[model samples]
Target: MQNKKLNIAFFGSSLVSAYWNGAATYYRGIVRALHNRGHQVTFYEPDAYQRQENRDIPDPEYAKVVVYPATQEAVYQMLEDAASADVVVKASGVGVFDELLEAEVLKLQSQNCLVIFWDVDAPATLDRVENDPADPFRAHVPQYDLILTYGGGDPVINAYAKLVAKKCVPIYNALDTATHYPVAPEERFQCDLAFLGNRLPDREARVEQFFLDVATKLPEQQFIIGGSGWGDKPMSANVNYIGHVYTKEHNAFNCTPKAVLNISRESMARYGFSPATRVFEAAGASACIITDYWEGIDFFFEPETEILVAKDGAEVAELLQGLTPERAKAIGEAAYKKVLAQHTYGHRADELEQLLLTTPRTATAAPSSADAFVS
Candidate 1:
């Protein structure tokens, strides 16, 4: 337990909104736990008004929410906040001012504050940085005191280390058992297989391969896709397309499906050990899950017993056809037990606290200018 109450400043996407941003759940779970432990947290976000309006939470009780305009004044205010904080975290995919925030927040490390670049999408960020010589973030990588990632495991850690990152830690996503547990199945999400994810370029092809293709293979089985940007995708007769399932409905959505499908983005799958939030959410609902094969999966859950793995659409179809109700129930139960025991946000909060406590807070050379952040 932390003896002193630390004032943490988090600059990230809308904490109150689940619209478009995938990190809301991650932020909520971890930040809420920290708040529970008697720490003060202030969350800063840009006024992406649409997301704000569609917010699941207008105001988050866990942190002081500040929605600033995308202006130079706002940038300066954010920097001031970062400089004064005990631990300042700039999470990736802020949807606005990401580059500016990353560069400016790194500058706060000189003031003896622990500035961390928390990469929610590590593989995508790594790909852009390593592959693109013009990537802006490459130069800024080594500036932060510590780098924490939601996923990407060793590949991300090793890649960032090569970039001269001071220290890198992979803080994988975990279940918030309190909010995401087995609920009675709902009728709206009832289907043989269900998937919930916003369509992004990196994940679209994999979804087609693992979800749509498999749905086609098993035409007799009812399939449902619940997410945004997927309305444009063509669907088979047996497939139901429920555009976007709100945060409140996730449990019902997870519970309703006989077997939920988890299709990782190409980068995430290649990087491995990157279980999407959907995996844990569905498991919390005790829904049988069938996921595409990815590296280091055994690190999270035992593949055959706790979860099902599919190599291709044919394999997905085979699993769907062969998995008995009893076997599926057993797998779901096993996964739930595993998550409750080892992979909850409470466990992650402890790890995060330990990391912050142990990490050396030595000052690094200051960044040249905001323009230096340019790729």
Candidate 2:
């Protein structure tokens, strides 16, 4: 995989802004790791969703960023600019002109170059295509040279294979130690339990059950909730809502809480094997985490030792009942050691680099894989 540096062009949501874009941390970690490996990357993003107005970072030297107007002509121009790269990637949820970009990127496929579709949210995506027969993106599944997912493990792999995607790989999330490591606690973030995630429909119910409900059960315990759109939601008197924690503040947010909570969205919990970025961020901060029970968690973290798993509010309350600061610190330390050893974005980049080096380079296709998928 480290044989030679490849020129890569990436199209996705904002790389410099976490505003309304949950995949920003993921993009930065993976892209920066690839850069450290000596690969050159040019990132293309649309000027939409007010991301430019509320950027978490300035133009980074790791990747060349090209922000284009959200117009039809800009999509075509971006494709033309990326055509000469050794490998071109079109990531999911770019916010504008995504359909056009997804379909047209495949047209650049050739013998000397490879085109890939990287789905950052496979659980939601697979679920969407599964329910909708007339989905336009469903047809483009087989056109890309390979399908790469940020999470979703074997479930995602099998789903994509059924769609007859020539190949599918899961590049699970990991810590970027440089960005998300331990930080000194801040007074504003100190609490018994802290949870941070933007408000989305698929996740709100789960958050209510796992976080807000748990807060109600233990009225004596102080709880802090961060991220966008929760300011209006009713919460227990013991609960504190801090709106929209930025990427730079993630470490403090994780560290200040006695034990942070990680609740997956409904589709992700139903599909399993999906660990959100919060899990790693907490572990990196050496902050104990109580994550909702899901499949494949043990593969990443040892339950009851490295991490605490709770299936419902009752389970979370019980776990909190016995959790002392000393015990919490021990669990946090163990989780940190484990993730640093196996689950950082550096590790994910290595996995991706290997897959790219081994995948078939020619423009090719598998049969329409929607065979099992549609049924």
Candidate 3:
């Protein structure tokens, strides 16, 4: 007999566009892809921030959005909603009440609901839990039926194994082909080089080292920076800052730049194979890319032909100076082709489907009759 289509509940922090975080984009892409594949997805998020502010993309049609409060009653309501789901996923870093949500999800697992703790910020989560003996998530890891990550390849695998996750899969960041692809350059975003990333402690230094420092050395080039929390930073006249470009504008931002800059976070850079969403975004837009050195990069794209890798500001300056526009465009096109062929939300959804099929369903807790449904 064919297996029944699973009812899936995706619990993340924010589904609103105003948040405009990488996690929001990842959720939007993966959940939308899953819905396209005929899986029933109910997305749960808190209405802490009005998502309409600076909204870029329209609300998703495929998934149902549930806004919950920050109390135990809300947790109970979430569990009730997830009771019929074959898989209940608690995504990491859901800003407001994620800890409570995770606890409730874990409790539901005791009643036979399959629970997944999807870690978007694997490195930071692992580091935080590892350092604090009192961390609640540390003890709960082993209870989760599956662990999924957005990035952090080997290091994440090792860390989860140590934590005793039954199955840990790194569902790395991928291009949302429908949203990100080649487009005509827009005048507002036109620049010789552009970098888009939010401010984070681990990533700030690398940004300074690779992006800001490089800008100072290349006074002749017009560089652009796009993301949140850089308004206070002193910038050179040659470098322009565009605050928080939305998902809809990513293509224009990428296509308008001669080359886009990518700097991996400290843990991701150390673990390798952990390409950020921006790498695929710029590549999908057929924009030339210059990235900082990271191990296992060759597995995704050819260093010189598909994408340029720089070790420091000096290497960045050299690539900016030496690479011809034609050659850069050719490289961008190559990377774009590679990304469309191998890395997209469609591919990720397929991988996730396979993983779900292969993983043994936990039989410890069975859903109540009213909480179970047939597709």
Candidate 4:
């Protein structure tokens, strides 16, 4: 896919801020890799003032960042940009005017351009659209040329097919090897177990079951939580709650933990194969990762050898207590090697390019399971 100089236009939430948005790292990684491959990319984001102020990067080097208001003029300008690009992608959960963007972006479909609906949280988005008959974007699924998802293996593709989506593909979360490599451990983040994620309604219960419960069961082990919104929650004496860890601190935070925990949101877990950005980030830092059982785990890493899996608090305690430092290091190294080989942003960029070039102009009415990559 090298030297495939295509102009790509992307519309999504803050690419500069990791404040409340989890897609920042993914957008940065994929966009940078695409640009490095000689594609001209432009990212359009709404004037989400708070996210703008809390941005880790005020400006990104890879893509031309364009912040637009929700006015009529801004909408027209955005459409113009999309119409001119070879491929235009409207990602889910943009935090503002997402319904409008999804419905209208399909209008840019033409012989020279392709329009895609990129679902970052496929499970949540599918739930909303499938359950709610009044969902405005329900009818627009078939209008776009292709549907791309961050995660959700066959479950997501099949669900979109039910909605008569033309074509659906899963592009799971991958590591940015250059940005998320090993780093020296920081004293503040040192702990036996660590879990980092924003406190959201769908995830807090799982965090309690997987993270907080395990912490309570093993009183002697040090557990750390790094993310926003858990401040008011009850904490055990051995547990440490750091309010928020910016993107720059991810490596140190991952490196400091003896074993990092990955607790998928309930929806993602139920659907299976939906790996959060934390999985790749932690693995890239060569941290021994212990994640809850999810389908398609084998697609990314070989469990027990490359990664560890735990079903409940008892298992979590057992794994944490059983592994020696040498064994843990070996597991982390194996996971790191697996991600570098098949689950990096560079790989995703190549997949995207191939998908774009190969997908039919007129998508089939029913989705086929033919186009899928496990990593």
Worst 10 residues of 2 by lDDT: 366-375
RMSD of every candidate to native, in Å, equals 2.9, 4.8, 3.3, 6.0
lDDT of 1 at 212: 91
- Candidate 1: tens digits of C-alpha lDDT, residues 1-375: 247678899988888888888888888888988888888899998888478777877687889988888776776766775566778899999888788787777666744468899999998898888789888899888778899999888888899999999999988888987678988888878788888899999899888888898888788899999888887789888999988678888988887777899999889999997898878878888878899999988988999899999988889888999987788889999999998998888898898888876677755654544533332
**lDDT of candidate 4 over 236-338, digit per residue (tens):** 9999999778998999999878889999989999999899888999999999999998898888999999999988767888999997889889999999999
Which residue segments of model 4 deviate by more than 4 Å? Answer: 1-4, 70-73, 362-375
State the lDDT of candidate 3 residue by residue for 1-375, as single tens digits.
025576788888776563546677678779888888788889887655555455666567978888787565665667777877877899997776777777667655633356899998888888888899899988889888899998777878999999988879999788888788898899998878899998887899999888888899889889999898899998899999989888888899999888999999887787777888889889999989999999878878999999999998789888998978899899999999999999899999898887765566666666453453221
Candidate 3 residue pairs in backbone clash: 112-365
Q: Highest TM-score, which number?
A: 2
TM-score of each: 0.94, 0.95, 0.93, 0.93
* Residue range 40-86, candidate 2, lDDT tens digits: 99999999989999999999989999999998877777877787788
Candidate lDDT scores, in order, read 0.84, 0.88, 0.82, 0.86
Better by TM-score, candidate 3 or 1: 1
Candidate 4 global TM-score: 0.93
User: Over 4 Å off in model 3, which ranges?
Assistant: 1-3, 18-20, 49-52, 70-72, 110-112, 366-375
Candidate ordering by lDDT (highest first): 2, 4, 1, 3
Minimum summed lDDT over a 10-residue window in model 1 is located at 366-375
Error of 1 at 256 (Å): 1.4
